[model samples]
Target chain A: MTSESDRSRRDVLILGAATALVGAGLAGPAAAELKTVVYNNSGGASADAARAAWGGLMRDRASSNLLVTAPASVARLKAMIQARNVEWDVAELVSQEHKQAIRESMLQKLDLSVIDLSHTPDDCKDEYSVVYALYSTAMAYSSKIAAAKRPGSWAEFWDVAKFPGRRALRNHPVDNLEFALLADGVPKDKIYPIDFDRAFASLDRIKKHIAVWWRDGSQPAQMLIDGEVDFTSGWHGRFFALAQKGETGFGVQWNQAMLKRSWVGVPQGAKNPREAMQLISFMIDPTASAKYAEGIGYICCDARANNHLPENVRPWVMSNPAIAELTVSANEQWWLDNGELAQRKWNDWIVT
Target chain B: MVRRWFWIPGLGFLVLFFLLPVGAFLLQSVLDPGPTFMHFERLFEGRAFWVSLGNTFRISITVTLICAVIGFLIALRIATLQRPYANALLVLIVMTVWISLLVRNYAWMVLLGREGIISTSLVALGIFERKTSLLFNEAAVVLGMVHVLIPYMIIPTYAAVQAIDPALLRACDSLGARPAQVFSRVLLPLSLPGLATGCLLVFTLSLGFYVTPAILGGRGQTTLTMLMEIEVNEQLNWGFAAAHAAVLIAITAVLFFAYRSKFGMDRLWGQEL
Candidate 1:
């Protein structure tokens, strides 16, 4: 009986080992045969939209599988590049981070031939990256407030006597510094290389009147709709999305909006650089860009995408001539140089 | 020898997954880009770090103390209950822990917002002349954290209280001790080790909290974890983040050792050392 049991156990062990070896061998070659381009972006609605817009195109054009990952982190990018284990083939970067990555040599130079930028603005193109979309940090208010009483400008928004309602600003330093400078009557062109002393002084004047300093991207609009605050600084795209859905409880004021670019780039040492470049090219195709813009309520940099958009959506797009004329482009180069010190100062200042 | 071999899998998992990664990350504090104390020096020099550290300790202590008082009373009640009833109540308490932390925080958000149920009811009841948002403040953060952590406090205390011999209490009563006197003298002392363990667990967990404070709190509520997040995510300063983590780990270790020395390690497992 013992010998019979032993013989069966030996046969089972040998069969199991053979199966494992065969599985490993198949996985090695199969993985090599299939090309996958990993695209990491700020997840949520944008990621979903990108997958819908370009995932199929990437598969058809590049013959590569598209993998998506969440909430882009520059620190992770740095760590991966430093370790020589880059995981993302294509990654999205905010304007300041785009500049910072270039400075640190963490991004690969774009093959402009593969990624056409003929319709893209000159300002949107760079040696290592291209601005794919534009979003604005603008003031939004509850629709319950009358138009006459609305604080139209940053200066007006700061005037507690005129507006006479609860207010919330973003807890971060980036847009708040610019807003403070504008509120202090600094011209839009003169806002860069920020005058910190003047800006903080302006912030001090209105700090006590502010009801809340919001952190999350969703907080400002939610606060507005819920009537937690009558006015808040929020991203324009959030309010635009709500408006598109016919939810008019919140109204966005595009006047003096801080226009920020969202960039796409290939990271250094990407496994499939050519496929990553192809994916970028696919993302900026007019039809795909329009669909992505309509889905997320953010305007793509390519002006031709405007032709594909519905007439009603054009006014909401930041690139429309009328809206573009009124907005200010944030100086990302200045932020790239001084972001760390600015953040430290902002953290100290907010608590105090 | 056969039993000793059984430890290999568990010990190997801890060493490979926990110890190696944590050790390497912490080592980056001093060794990254070369051996230097600049990260620590920078951390000490920053005023925000100190402010956040103070907020972290203050919030943790408050949560721990509140949990201890409330947890002990609940535990005492459960200890005296019939077996099935006690088990049912214990299951209910543990069930709350199974709910997503994000869901709980969002529920609190709805309850505490300006036009939320709490604010509207309070205004209608004439408790306040105007509706006020109770969210995005220190109180909301404490409340959210206490809700999540109370189970940790109750479970350990219940075990300790259940381990108490009923004869000892009866003996004390026969010796002419009052109800309050029995509690203060006998029950409290016997349950001290369990209470200590619960406090340590809750306090350490509270110190590392990120979501509760971030979701429910305003500008003034930044904690050590939030500061570390900003460093790692926004500033891309890994070495500085490593330094912050190292400090947090050191403080936790010290508190643990202090607890271990006072209570003896076996009390952690509901036994006398």
Candidate 2:
């Protein structure tokens, strides 16, 4: 019985190795013909928008295949880089993830000559990454509430007695801490290196008032549309998408909006770094950026893209000077340093 | 010789696909970067870890108890019914399991939301003064979990109930025992093993629940799995996440062994040990 089991195990091992070899053999020949640049980004409508914007452009212009992957993850990036098996040529990093990636040396420095960022805003450009799209965690309200009773700012949002309604906030520390600080009367510029004590104190006041602590990006806008919530802190693009669909029951308040940048960077040890840079350059081209923005409500950081945008799209986008002025950029560096602590505290606070 | 060969493939699959990766990942809790208990140390230091751990056990126990009670009743009813009726009822219970868990959770969200059917109907019928959201609470999370996990409970309990000898039940009934007494003495004891198996299944599944709680539950429903996700995805602290996973694995292993010792392995396969 022992001999039989040992022979069976050896046979199983041989079968596995043969299968793996066959699989690799099939993939190797196809991969050698055309250079593939895997661009990993947050999937769903955004991925679709990206494909619509540059799928043809990457193939036609760069003579490379654009293989888009889903739900961009910094953890996956770290693993890939650590294992010395980098799969993604270009990866989209959400908020402070780029900073964390850069800190860990998980990303390659951008070759500015290949990826032209001169047209991009100075604040949006980094040595290792560039902000491709601009979005905000902004306040949105249901049209069911009277216009007069609508909360315009964080302070007003906290005043539950005045603007009484079911409210939802994102179930995270990133934007909520800033919102708490702002509601506690911290000036927009002064709202960095956050005082956790003051912020939590402020949050403690409005804690019971918040009906839902929404986890997903789509939840806040959907909640408003469903009348599940009257006021919510949600991504601006979600509300914009709904408005574009002619759903007029919700209105976004841009006042004190937490302006966030979506970054794209080449992972360190990527196979096709040059092609990846070229793809990034193509993505930020004025026409391409404008088309992408139209597909999804998230505007690219390129100021030149504003010229190609239609008049209707201008007021809604972050690139508009009027809207841009009302927004505050979150301190990504601070978040990079203290994210774990903030997460722990936030988790503790919520449960207690 | 053929049976031995069959064992190799299954054993190899488990070793390669499950054990090797999981063992390496769990090892990271101590051995990551260097050998240290820092991750575990930090885990214990945080209130979030303790609270979420408590929440996980509390929710799992609640879900297990609820599933056991409901499942036993349903199984008992089905066992007494005609074969055709019983099969149909069992199929209906099993059908819910086929639906995606996310779809089911979202359905509950629609049903329990502020302007949802139940809320609106309640208000219209004057049962409620106004539409109030029945969602974003521990109750909603439990309801969602119980909905998803009920099938796991019912299937096992039904098997055990159907296996019970009708003659034995008749033997008790003919001894001038009351209907309640017969059930209490014979059927209940006979069903305990199945109910225990169901409870184990439901409880363990509940411990690892992530999506339902995140969607249906509010601030209070943060479970260990949810916390682990934040650690892995948001915090990018694999060592810490591994520590969380290790703790969960340890508890589950302990529970599994206890179950195995109490009810021998054959009981798990519907054998009356």
Candidate 3:
């Protein structure tokens, strides 16, 4: 309890009033309907989107409201579940995280009847979650970089002699495996059921030239902007954001753009699970999704969401379905099954 | 009757805020999902674990030594200043703590980045033909940690320095002791507790550092905190994370007792250092 008696009693009163308000009638009063709902995310761009596009839009319309938080971790989720005290009403999860949460029964099952998934991509939807936004693990290079030519494929990315500059990539093996396979001459269509031997071999080729094995989505972009690395494979939005600011000499090669997806799942035993599920459905609305994508520079998984955006604006936004079709969707299940092994291998590979 | 029971609130604070939660965490490290010691086993099983542990101690000690040497001079300067000047120096030192850790790390990035201010300024002055990679190096990591943790060291040492009797300094001066002799023989020995306290504070605080190393340091700079983060955040291995945390706790506990034997426990008490 707080040292201040006023605050301690007020917290108790708020709890009592919230319960009484819920018990009175589910949809009785606008002010009382959602006394509290804690929405958790991985923070940064995603949190900003929820605050502006979703929370800002629904502030006047809905009785329920969201209080945003930063960087949800499964460890925290498990600890809360074990203590029988859940804080997050709605938690943003990756595809594999959604799977793990489902296995642990750490998330509530969704009711599709309430959620109109007509606009949401079928492959994107999950048992306990709704898809949020899409990004890419694509090639980034400085046009001003000294080389015979720029790298357009993973094979060329491995060729340090031609590139002749330091490079940056994520520290994880999720997309790196696929990129390595592609670099080893595996066709884009036939990249799955990955040949591990060849992939690691492909990695060993360029591993020495990699100046930085960045961990965050934005680090590689920042490195490229700072000229710490001549090339990198990072989130397209990172370089795109820089480009829109009139920063020159940067180019993106989206040929092998691998789609990265995010989802929103209700944590099991949340105080407002029903309200959280409803909010998920509400956010899947095309206008909200597009406004979210526009504000955050991520692609909305719902194709129709971009229809709300002007055609000229879509070019700058990377919201085009044509480019989406060309880009390959990451096999989340493959990673989910082999993730620990791959991650261990990645850790050993980098450290040594 | 209740006047002597003032310690109840303090005891309540420790039990409610510290003991119960830490007890749960340690218990879970051994017995989450099912009763097991596999989490503890995991701590010793990997090369990554050993590497992270080694790096954490290495970086923290390096930061501690740097902080101790520089911070003592700062404290000594502040302690010997005129009243207004001493207050002004302290305010300047304390002002840095007001800025959040993340902003400070980002500021370091902007200054030390390849295209950052220092590099650009140097390049403009014809120092180099091309930009050099300055950030994401060991030097940057140490620089960032020292900048953030020095204040922790300075505050306690400053307190210790201020508490020394001015009459002792005057007595040494009256005995015809030179300034250097006065400091080395009298002030230095007297200020040992503060120096010890400051070093301990900076050393312990640096062990849990995350954002600075994560932002300013790259692959080679990865510490135990980052490794635990990988286990907890990326791998979702809380059992292993808890075990790793237990290792840190056990190490800190041993150090706590070690420091207690050398300098009384009263100094480390009440500060949460």
Native A-B contact fraction in model 3: 0.28
Worst 10 residues of 2 chain B by lDDT: B264-273
Question: What are the runs in model 1 whose C-alpha is more than 4 Å off?
Answer: A1-36, A82-85, B3-6, B269-273
Q: Candidate 3 lDDT, tens digit per residue, B158-273?
A: 66676666777778878999988988998788777878987887888888888878888877777878877887788877777788889998898899789999988876432322
The alpha-carbon lDDT assigned to residue B49 of candidate 2 equals 89
DockQ comparisons of all candidates to the true complex: 0.22, 0.25, 0.23
Q: Which candidate achieves the best lDDT against the true structure?
A: 2
Chain A TM-score across all models, in listed order: 0.87, 0.88, 0.84
Alpha-carbon deviation at B227 in model 1, angstroms: 1.1
After TM-score superposition, the amount by which residue A348's alpha carbon in candidate 3 deviates from its true location, in angstroms, is: 3.3
* Ten-residue region with minimum lDDT total, candidate 3 chain A: A1-10
Q: Which pairs of residues collide in model 2?
A: none
lDDT tens per residue, model 2, A27-77: 342454568888998876677778888888988888888888878899999
Ranking by lDDT: 2, 1, 3
Clashing pairs in 3: none
